[model samples]
Target chain A: MIHDFLIYFLLIVLIYTIIVMSFNLAVGFTGLVNLGHMVFFGIGAYASALLALSGAPWYLAVPSSALIAALSGAIIAALTVRLKGDYFQIVTLGLVFIAVTLSRNWISLTRGALGLPGVPPIFKDSLHYMIFVMAVFALSVIFFYWLTNSGTGKIFQAIRDDETASSVLGKNTYFYKILSITISTFFAGLAGSLFVHYIKFVDPTIFDLEFFVLILSMLIAGGLASIQGSIAGVFTLGIFVELIRFIDRVPLLSTVLAQHPELIGASRTMVYSVIVIYLLIFRPRGIFGRVEV
Target chain B: MPSILPQLIINGLIAGSIYALAAAGFALVYYVLKFQYFSHGAIMSIAAYSFFAFLNLMGMNYLFSGALTVIISILATLLTNFLIYNPLRKRRATSNIKLIVSVVLLIFATALLQAIFGSSTKSITLGQNKVFDFGTFTITSIQLSIIIIAIIIFLALWFILKKTRLGKAMRALADNKEVAQVVGISPEKIYTYTFIIAGMVAAVGGILLGLEQNLYPRMGIPIIVKGFVSSVVGGLGSVPGSIIGGLFIGLAENIGVLYFPTGYKDIISFVIMLLFLLLRPQGILGVKARDS
Candidate 1:
């Protein structure tokens, strides 16, 4: 029983690890707040699900999800690149609101809030799915490591550190920003596809601010701009979330919380918010992040 | 078409008033502080539930419930600033950090509200059968009061800004903080007053919202977004701009469904906001683009 739970837990941790890593490339490396990260994730899930249901092979759907999200990232970047930081965040948020509204309202395509269930998994078994995710994680980690060491990565950091200086140095900062967003969004889409296929479901609820908050918390906790930190954040927060799911089962704690039984779902989130506050106050750079500013 | 049109217009006007109210507060805070208080929505939720508690739990009359609830909201806003924002400001936290903290506070606060209130929708009973019908448009007295009170508040706000010392201090702070401080205008005191005003305004919006639709702990999220959209469209931090933006959105959404499904409302709003942002980001009032 415990072994099964651990495997399930590991799968979740791996899924979030991919998301946080992908998100870090934009937020930590490129300095775009990208508040609407979930829009890309949702698009990828729907794209992968619909394509697979229409007889596309797993390989085709997987890469196509990345393509679609990349295209979306490019378009959003084109429209919003002129704006500075917080405005960009709000624009992305608006996009998320629109995307979620569509997902819920375009009932024929998305099945609305009822969600699309019974979608087939890529590997058929949970253990096999975990292995598949592990392989993907390894390849992504390797790609990030290479990218970070390469000159392109340094340019990314330069732009993040100071866009004006980067522009003065003759770099097309907008192009680089778009490139960073494209790459990050591509992986985010991949993560979404992986998540949907593994869970065999897709829904409007997948696009809420909580998911963004969770991913942000993970990146901040694990330390931004580092693959290891991404992994650590995923493992720590993933386990924390999973553990909190069972907090209601703890006899002593449940009794103390019995008066507010409805709060069980809220307690873990409350705790997470506190932790995020502490982290931002003490280590805004994150647990593993090296950036001072 | 005519039947739906009047209803839409009426709906738009009422909703616009509420959005304008929300924007008034949002603009005041964002103008001075320059960070998205993502928790603004959660604060609305707190005010909403506080109103609910007073009206339903304590069985207070409408007037007393409304007044006490606004007071609770003001105190809550002050506490948040004192404990969270003030400390962060003291350290000169980056805009991004302050924004993140607000988001964290939003998450924690919304969850806390849920834990306390339970996640069901609550309503304020106004003893119905009093809705007045006008062939094409119908409105309840409470909603009428909402519009009336909203206009009154807007007028009061304009008066305060144009005439009061605190208001002058705030405009100065919003205009240029360092210079304002140098000229014997204490930014902290002005900001505190601005927050109080913002809180009171948000409470009115929340109370009206509770009366109009049902009240849910998370209802503030959408309300805040619309409020924010209005503020941004009007150009962030501009008082008149926020009101215009709010009314524009209210009208836009209602009028939009004539050509599209109601679900497209969010899309229409965002597209309008995007157009404003990409084109006249300084706002319709054409305030010098604060940040290029």
Candidate 2:
């Protein structure tokens, strides 16, 4: 039972590692500060969950999650790629809020925030599911590592450092940016699908602003742009996020908390937000972050 | 069908007035510093909470709490700018870095507020709110006061911008910082004053919103988003443009309920924001040449 729980926790950490690593590709590597990247995650979760719930095979649902998310990411990139600085952030903010609204209001599609239930597990046995999740995690890490070493990776860094210089060097910066965002969001989708299947639940809250903050906290805390950092962030912050379930078990602080138990609900996010602020101020580069913005 | 136009119009104007107040504050900061002030939204919550504490905890009257909170909010905003943002600005950090810092401050403030105040929603004005009736539509006195006070503040700001020496200095700094400095206007001083004034207006907006709706830690994000959209959609640096943009958003969102579900009202503003960005990022009053 303990092993099963550990496996479940590790699977979650790995899934988020995939998601945040993808985020790092854009924010840390490509210099595209997409404030609305959660839209892709939402798309992945909704597409795969809906597909699986409607009796589509896992083979079709999972790939479609990646494909649909990537396509949507590409579309957003195409439309808003020209928006520089504040305008870019504003538009991305608009796009994602729209996605959230859709997820919330499209009751027939998303079940209207009440959340969907009884999502089928990929494998019946806990051990086999753990191995399956681990395989996917391995694949994601390998893919990101390969991406970091490829010529395209250098181009992405160049765009981040100086877009005009790279453009002057005859590199199609816009195309590379769109490509990076698409790839990043593809992995985000995969992560989202994994998340849904593991937890066996999906809801509009999955794409809420707090969820974005949680993922962002992980990316920043673990160190941006590095695979190791992504892993560290997912593991550490994922535990912090999951601690709400065991909030009562936390020692030393439990006495003060025993007085007002209602605070247990908001304490995790509160701590995460404070940590993010401190990290930004004191260690902007993060533990494993190689680049500074 | 019943004539819902008057009711909708009243709501729109009241909401728009509050948005305009906030947007105007936002524009004041953006015009000179040139970064989207991420903590601008939280200023409202800070003021609102302070207002609440002074009223309820300290046993102060509404007027005293309101004035005291506004002053406190302004000072806090100035402190943040002087301590955090100014040092970074001196280092010649990128706008992205400034943006991130502001965002962090915003998130931190919201979280800290929740931690200190607890998660429960708190209201400033106690008991049942009094509603005023027109011939066809009903409006609350508090809501009507928001519109009236908003118009008064707007005119006051316009007067300052048009006639006052400090406002002239501010405009000079915004127009061309180097030239303004050459003319002996201290950019740092202007920044300090602008942030304070911005905070004051934000406090007013906060008070209005708390009276209209309710107060909570996370209330600032959505309010801030609306203010930002209004500012950007109207014109980034233009003050009157913010008012127009705010009204437009308020009306559009209110009327959109006829076609869209109530939950999708904010969605409509976002769509409009996208349309404005793609088609006319300059906004209604913005100069085309300045857009790039």
**Docking model 2 quality class:** acceptable
**Model 1 regions lying over 4 Å from their true place:** A249-252
Error of 1 at B191 (Å): 2.4
DockQ of each: 0.61, 0.46
What TM-score would every model get versus the actual structure?
0.96, 0.91
Lowest lDDT sum, 10 consecutive residues, model 1 chain A, at A284-293
Give the alpha-carbon lDDT of every model: 0.83, 0.82
Q: What pairs collide in candidate 1?
A: A223-A288
Q: How far in Å is the alpha carbon of A69 misplaced in model 1? A: 1.0
Interface DockQ of candidate 2? 0.46
Candidate 1, B140-243: lDDT as tens digits: 88889889999998998888888998778878887788899899987778778878888888788888888888887678788888888999898888888899
Worst 10 residues of 1 chain B by lDDT: B283-292
Clashing pairs in 2: none
Candidate that would win on lDDT:
1
